[model samples]
Target: MMSKNPNLTLTGPDLAALLCSRVCHDVISPVGAINNGLELLDEGGADSDAMDLIRTSALNASVRLKFARLAFGASGSVGASIDTGEAERAAKDFAVAEKKTEVIWNGPRAIVAKNRVKLLLNLFLVAYSSIPRGGTLELTLENPEFDAKFKIVARGKLMRVPAKFVEITSGQVEEAIDAHSIQPYYTVLLAEECGMELGHSATGEEIIFTAESVSV
Candidate 1:
């Protein structure tokens, strides 16, 4: 939906605000359910049901927070690298939070640059979006230390790539950036900043996202 635009402009504060809103949007539902469960218990409704809701909602909140931390937070100082094992846990947890996607992580347990991990998480989110009817998210990193390439396959009963999502990821957006598009936008930004080539395509029921490091 979008072509490469090196000047996809967004102010630093605005991007931060939108991404914050996006993270809040993701956690609000589960957090609200937690509050609802508590109120139900206060009303003396079926304690079993209330407790179940509270427990599940709490776990969901925890999972989402973990994913957000890796996907959006500054994990460390400059030049920091994250362990691939940790990235795998975040990816797997995010899929669980969605309740319909399964994550297959084949990346090594070695350390990878922070930007690389962030881009990986964002691509996982993109693939998750494509599979609306529950699916498998197969993510891989080949040769992490040198000639690194990341691949994510999204396969499902029903799959779609939003025109806007494609536009943002491909760096072709001329419109104002909003929370809906910020995730992909950030993914592309990270790829560009890290000298990683970003691309995506769909085949039959599968949507594939890839990023490859480019030599200087």
Candidate 2:
């Protein structure tokens, strides 16, 4: 899954396109399953158990699609702001949807640029990856103003950070970036584009992220 990085440099448009493709790739299988379930219902008549299973599967797929749309895809106009309430719901749903991590958001309701929400969601995934079995991720905001500082704390029994992901975020391993490591790399790029600075630290049982406005 090599990214189209011309001149060995990933551009904004390249990352955007890659993320869009990634989300689509993830949602396609579940969506296709839902479609298949629908076809089965049409042909098989009223089967209660089968209908119940299909309903649950459809709901799961819908939740995932919504989460992917908010987290990876563009939510609105280029410079438009998104409601933090909506972002919070999407993040919580996404975290629970995976059934691997539980998220606790501690912040006030405030509007921020959609890019910041995108960065936040990407950071969530990074933290989620640290936990092998299951874990708790706590996202906190130091300030809920237009230009705010946020922190992400993830804790689990086994926490492992991938070197490639760290390197990509630091812009240290540009040539090694592929579809798997692109999210972390793109998170860093998007943060900088939105005038923010991002840093991460990891311990044996935890990984912490700190992001603040560069304008500060």
Q: Model 1, residue 105: what's the lDDT?
A: 87
Clash pairs (backbone) in predicted model 1? 2-167
Give the clash total for candidate 2: 0
User: What TM-score would every model get versus the actual structure?
Assistant: 0.94, 0.83
Q: For residues 1-216, write the lDDT of model 1, one tens digit per residue.
A: 232455457778988999999999999999999999999999989999999999999999999999889889998898899998888998887778668889998857788888888888888888788888888989989988667899998899878886776777655677878988888888877887778888888889688889998887
For model 1, the superposed segments whose C-alpha errors exceed 4 Å read 1-4
- Model 2: how far is 133 from its true place, Å? 1.8
Q: Which candidate wins on TM-score?
A: 1
Worst 10 residues of 2 by lDDT: 1-10
Candidate topping lDDT: 1
List the RMSD of every prediction in angstroms.
2.7, 4.2
lDDT of each: 0.84, 0.75
Q: Which regions of candidate 2 fall more than 4 Å away from where they truly are?
A: 1-8, 35-49, 174-176
Error of 2 at 1 (Å): 28
